[model samples]
Target chain A: MPSPRYTRDIPARYRLDAARCSACGHVALPRRTICSGCRSQDMEPVRLTRRGTVVTSTVIHVPPDEFTTEAPYAMAIIETPEGARLMAQVVDCQAEEVVPGMELSLEFRRIRREGHGGILCYGHKGVPVRRHEA
Target chain B: MRDVAIVGAGMTRFGELWDASLRDLFVEAALAGLGSAGADRVDSIYVGNMAAGQFVGQEHLGPLMADHLGMHGVPAVRIESACASGGAALRMGFLDIASGQSDLVLVAGVEKMTDGADVTNVLATASDQETEVYHGITFPGLYAMIARLRMERGTTTEEDLHWIAVKNHRHGAMNPKAQFRREISVDDVARSTMVAEPLRMLHCSPVSDGAAAVLLAPLDQARRYTDRPVRIAGSGMATSTIALADRPDPADLDVVRLSAERAYAMAGMSPERVQLAEVHDCFTVAEVCCLEALHLANGSEASQAARTGYSALGGRVPVNTSGGLKSKGHPVGATGVAQVIELFDQLRGEAGERQVPDAHVGLAQNMGGSGASSVVHILERV
Candidate 1:
């Protein structure tokens, strides 16, 4: 997997962000150019939390190419504390061990290699939050 | 805008067509529609396709299709909205006809995905590839999360999801053009290899290659071509955040609801009046979400409907009577238009054994990526 790296400065990354309405208290992802809820242009950027819980998950046995090597890997939609949700891989755990409501923390991991090391795309991956030993 | 009607419909047998190229699939379906309509000419053409550049390493579908279909120099445009491309194309066709700018128009959708290419990488183009696919979130994994959340909400069960697959497969067995013509039991879905945790192989639609086409004309002129013209009563479309995590309600699809509302308002009908529908069942849970979004049933009632056979043939409201994406196949661009074809047959009472009795009003809801985009159309038998 390509290592997880934030491409916020890059134009091609399609970074995940939200638009907070100044009037109607509405929030939207992708940092809308104008708030659809209140039609307010006074929106601001809010970086999503790096932690969340598994709302649901799936394992693809017959996987896709960038994901073929990780066939049967666990993937889930993690709802962050900021109320934003994104589909991501749930690693560092068995496929069966993952379940809804399991707390997860975002981590960097290799997703894929592009064009014989031309570009290495990286992003967030989730891992079950291991409880600290007493 | 003036009303539009589907003057004709056509599609190729959906499955793995190893012998056919993208152009072949497209030309075949377009020609079939032209032949069905008996129209010697078209004012404009619209083609719905998701990823021709990725699937077949080709793009610029408009000119290519127009040339191959022997309609070169005609105004041709391609619409892309992920899986809802076909529905979007149909809407564009509707606008062209409704505006009185065109008398006869052709709208076709085609996708050739069986070239044995790396589909995973290709499909990843649909989502936030960097944020989502980077961690290995396949399409199945994305939907599995929805299923798991639905389960946690006590709105549905694994068995309910299984029933959807089983029913669709049963219906697919009767569809001559279906990719998977064999029926599968609920056990098959439960026991099948897990693609995404709760979602199994059978619970998902196959990567298919096919084409579907339809001829659209003004409602007043529709009768000149075919006595069985299906009048398009209403059309609605909505778009949401491209990323699923951005949606406020993971279980709710406001886009479908909003689109349905707009369509129902235009059609002068309500969900309660729809007798049958062809919904985007790209995944089992998608059907459930569609049912809710359409307000055909309350939230989560889709699973109950599936389990009790209410969504099957001869049920409360037949859904996916054409086998849905699960059984019929999801050739991306072709799926939405194919759903309309099924409704066209049903409205004309020509759906054979799968026909819903006294089916006068029908609806087709086609969606793209994680409920981010949707188009709904209401069709009535004239």
Candidate 2:
């Protein structure tokens, strides 16, 4: 089989970082090389808030190759404290526990392991930041 | 530029076509399209395919498809833009006609996904291999992340996403060309096995084997082929960064927006003016995000509208009337042109029970690889 392509750096060790347009107030996540809205190259590297909230999510039973072992994992589109919106896996929760507006925090975890003898990959995953964690 | 119109459209039943070969599927669709157009000869051929080399260990699909269709020695070109390959091929064929380069052209897309290969790995090839896939993100995982972010932004809801799958599947049940031709309820979608978090088995399109083709020619020439011709009023295509994380907002698909903007501008219409649409619903969340990007509904209002049947066949501005990629079956390369075929049938009033009454104007939005590429086309009755 052909090697898999890791297209996005977000959620991975790269954990999408970006800067917003100060003039237009458009948030730029994953560190835009050039703002598509304002074309502003004058950007800053801003770390995204570790904490976020689940705005929407899905449970994928049928997964692609490297992710086969992790079927039925909760994936969500989360918004961070800095108003940064990204897609990440929701960890430390059952599939049914994922819901809209659920607060979460970012963490580095194993995303997928390659072929039988291949390498195991790591990335940023989102876990619910709840009051019961005490 | 001359006005290009779709004179003929053809599509095979989409599903696990184990008995069919890639070339066989392409030829079947191409021959049907040619027969419908009553054309004895094709001036040129264009094929849209995502990863034939990876999926079937076959490359050079352009000439291969041409030869298989018996249009040997013609100018055969292959178009690739991940999942948008079919739409991209249609654009190329459209240009050929509008430019007066060809009077009769064959635009086709096909993929043998269930060819007994490790399709999962093949599909991963559409992503940014070095960054996203290497980091262990599958397409579903990528979209799941997007759904999560959309939730945080209050852009959409899980129920909204589920409605997309359920509605498309409902429409798909009426489509003989669809792969999974069974109706599914929102509960069925919600209860399906999970592939990635928040995305259930029923929320995603199946890996299918199928083919679709459209015959394009000058509007004046189209009349000689068919009395009820569907005119290609406008087409728009755009690209984004390969990496999902490279995008500014994981929840938003600006490429689809840009393409829709250009297409709508060229067609002199707005989202409300479109009576029907066939969008790439590879995943349920994709449908929600795409609806927002196309301006079919406000991002925040998408979930509610979905629940209310605003995007259903009998509702205002019907969406995925042919079940979309979700139920229609996604053969990757064949996905785009299949959308066009659905639009053609709807515009011609040939869409039987699933048809939207008086669907005069329609649109098709096809995406490639997690929204990295998108192609939008607006068509109307001539």
Candidate 3:
């Protein structure tokens, strides 16, 4: 990964930082200057909760080049409690077991190595919330 | 605004052509289109290409292609909208003629995807790189997520999705330009390797190398180029959120619906008047969603169209008569231009075996990544 690109997103990747639209109360993950809902520029920075719910998921058998070793992993669109949706890989559970409406706790992790000996990219991964914890 | 017409349409055989370079494909298709229109020169050229730098380590395609085609010194530009690049280029050409800026225009779309680049990674660039690709989500994985949502909603089944592949392959068998001409049964789709869960290999459009081109002129002067010209009655394009997760409803392709609506309104007709169609069926589920969004099928009709043979040739409303992206080959950028070529052939009564009976009106819908961008056009036989 390029250092500039990797370092620029550290706040969001490390802390789940997001921007809330002051006009519409819509939250944008990874932060944005403009709100998609109401097109407001009056945005406030906010950190989203580490927990979210799986809206949809797929078990990828044929992975991309950067993730060849991570084949058969579960990737999904997870909706945070603030209603901001973002994509993440669901781990620490069977790939096939990840389903919609399942509760998940996002954890900071190393997503992938950009290339052989390249910079290691970091992001959030979802772990299923156990029934006992509920 | 003046109306535009497609005076000529041509394309290369869509498949892995190891012999053809990117420039070779573009020039060949452009010359073919020119020949079909009985002309050798165009006032301007629009090249639609995605990821030329990534695929072939080349850029500045507009001047490069114009010079290669022996039409140097003419105004030329490249347009990119991911997979909808071709359609977007066509739209530009149409507007050029409609707005009376240029008399004759050439629109071409080409992609050489089998050039040893990381095809999966190259395609993933169409999605939100920071939010989606960084998490290792492939295009199939994104669509598979939608397929899961549709299945969970009881709107479609795995069998229903497989039937889309079967129907397209059957149609493709009749198209000599198609990559996969052999028809397969639902069992074949079921047995194919799963790229993403619930989406098999057969369900995904293959990475291909091909090019397609079309000649556009004002409708009044169309007869001078060709006696049987297909009028571009309507052209529409719309865009939405780049990431699939950003959609309010993951299962609904609102971009398709919005673009189709704009095209239908411009054409002064409804979906009911369309006798044939070529939609962006990059994935099987995409076709299902498109059918409903285009209003060709309503409610459950979209899911059942393949199983009931309603979307097959000789049926009520035949779709993808040119085999579509599924079997016809999806070279990404070339797909949208090829769809218009299919409509041109069908409207001009040039489509051989897969021709729709008395097909007077046709529609083509091309899309970018995960419904972020969509371009729709309606053609009428004149």
Best by DockQ: 3
Which residue runs of candidate 2 sit more than 4 Å off their true CA positions?
A1-134
lDDT of 1 by residue, B1-382 (tens): 7779998888999999898999999988888888888887799999999999989889999999999988898999999999999999999999999999999999999999989777766776787755566566677767777788888889889998999999998888889989998988877788898777788888889989999999999988998889889999999999986666666666777889999999999998978999999999999999998899898888656778877878989789989999999989999999989999999989999888787888899999999988889999999998
- By lDDT, the better pick of 1 and 2 is 1
Better of 1 and 2 by TM-score: 1
Sort candidate 2 into its docking category. acceptable
Q: Which candidate do you rate higher for DockQ, 2 or 3?
A: 3
| lDDT scores of the candidates, listed in order | 0.84, 0.83, 0.94
Question: Docking category for candidate 3?
Answer: high
Q: In model 3 chain B, where is the ten-residue run with the lowest total lDDT? A: B298-307
Q: Write model 2 residue lDDT over B74-135, tens digit each, in one string.
A: 99988999899999999999999999999999999999988778876677778867544544
TM-scores for candidates 1 onward, in order: 0.92, 0.83, 0.99
